[model samples]
Target: MNGKETYDKLKEMAFGEGIDLFRIADADCFLDSEYEGNRPQDFLEDVRSVIIIGSVVPNGVVDPLPKGRSQYTNTLMAATALLRVASFKLARFIERTGHWASIVPNEGSEFGYWYADKDTLRADLSVKWAAYCAGMGNYGINQLLITPEYGPRVRLTAILTDMVLDYDGKSMPLISDACGDCRRCIQVCPVQAIHEDGTFERFKCKEYMFSELGGLRCGLCLKVCPPGSGNP
Candidate 1:
């Protein structure tokens, strides 16, 4: 199949499998000087497409927040697990079609945290930025991709492949102008890691989740997000 044909087939398969969002981005999107994360090309030889596939973490799972962190964390992991299976199957299909495919770590992946830079606490690449580049959403002040449909409660996995596909460039600002003056996430953050200026203290967040919380994922920022919280 050609690029468009492959793109359509993959997208259909993803949605048919209950994945909520599916968008492909040209691997060169990472080459933009503004993107600071690891480049897709470095991860795979001649990587031509970054297939971003994800599903929204159910609002039911997010409502408890910092109160039930264990439940929240487990649900997030469950979501991640589902993505892994789907992406694995998709990758296998791609390879069967004569292209190489690989899956990147998503939320709740210890591999991502383990391989991350110690000082920066950043993974090999920013999956949120990859999602944004794919035109799936804009970044919120909390630094999570805020899709118009799901807001910040989305879980994403990236698939690197040599299949060239039709995709869009970044059409919105790096950060959404729509979240103006909204401090819900900052106010909800226990560690005060999020700042008004849109930057966050990754170490503080990491320490809070892994150290203070005993490895439970903090969903305060996600829980308080306006668009997806059903409170706005």
Candidate 2:
């Protein structure tokens, strides 16, 4: 099969496997001079595309936040778990198609993320960037990928592959167009971690979750990200 054919098969498999969101991002998007984060080429020199997959974090999960945080944390873990399993199958399928594939870890929004660089707290490469390039969603003021279907209430993972799949989409503005001057996320943040300028202090958010919340994930920034529209 060709690039488009392979992409369709992979999309079918991903969506059939219960992945609520799927997109193919031309790996070239990672080479942008503006993206200072790690690159997929660093891990796979021949990488040509990225498969972005995810499931929405049901509104139910976010509604009880700042209260049932333990449950909220576990629910996010559950979504990550689902993504990992589906990603494994997708990676194998891509490899069987005569191409190499690497699954990017979905460590964001987890408790005590072991895979992230401790000092920087970033994943090996930005799956969120790949997702953005694939047009799955756009960034919010809170620095979370806000999908039209679920706003920032989504969990995502990605597969870096050498297969030259048809790039289904192109990158847009770093932040969502709908993210106007709404600073609700910044206001609700207990640690003042989120900023109005679309930047944030990772350590501040991390410390608040780890030090004060006793390791339960904080969802305040997520809670006020005006669902779907991205503005309050």
Which residue pairs show backbone clashes in model 2?
A: none
| Candidate 2 lDDT over residue span 141-182, tens digit each | 888888877787888888888888898785577788766767
Off by over 4 Å in 1: 109-115, 227-232
User: Whole-model lDDT, candidate 2?
Assistant: 0.81
Backbone atom clashes (below 3 Å) for every candidate: 0, 0
Q: Which residue segments of model 2 deviate by more than 4 Å?
A: 108-113, 227-232
lDDT of 1: 0.80
Q: Could you list the CA RMSD of all candidates, in the order they appear? A: 2.3, 2.4
